[model samples]
Target: MVDYIDQHRERFGVEPICRILRRAGIQIAPSSYYAAKTRPPSPRAVADQQRLEMIRRVHVDNYGVYGVRKMHAELNRRGHRIARCTVHRLMRGDGLRGVS
Candidate 1:
């Protein structure tokens, strides 16, 4: 929604777009759009970026043969203390897969 607003803002303006969205029951305000645009990255997002780099390095270092299970174990064994589910989520999100 924010991206949509950004794309059309120069032509239609933010308030008008927000008004239309509100009329259509989307309930977004111009302030909401501005706030979203100005807000800094969240802690979780920062952590995810750092962890993703680590995951990529580990995956590549091992020839990309590690599946979720092995990847999770390797991260933990290296003192990352990350959950298996997190490893799985990040791997899947980045389209990183392992040999079956």
Candidate 2:
């Protein structure tokens, strides 16, 4: 069901996708997609945003001298509950790097 919705989400808008799915014997409704879209983000997403903000601050506060490993350790020490790879991804997205 999720795969069906994902496959058509781009080609067809949510309404049309739900219509097609309903016609094809799927139980999803347009309202479901609408509700999903309008719903607040999950806790993990909110936490990730906060963690990413911390990573950015740490990077900038150190004049971009913090790389993923150090950033990951620092975030862990600060109770962010994130992975080193996640720190790497966020730092890479923000174009931050170690002083080297």
TM-score of each: 0.85, 0.56
Best by TM-score: 1
Q: State each candidate's clash count.
A: 0, 0
How would you encode candidate 1's per-residue C-alpha lDDT over 1-72 as one tens digit per residue?
999998999999999999999999999988999999999999999999999999999999999999999999
- For 9-72, candidate 2 gives per-residue lDDT tens digits of 8887777877877888988887776677678989978977887788888778778787788888
Error of 1 at 4 (Å): 2.9
- Model 1 clash pairs are none
For all candidates in order, the CA lDDT equals: 0.95, 0.79
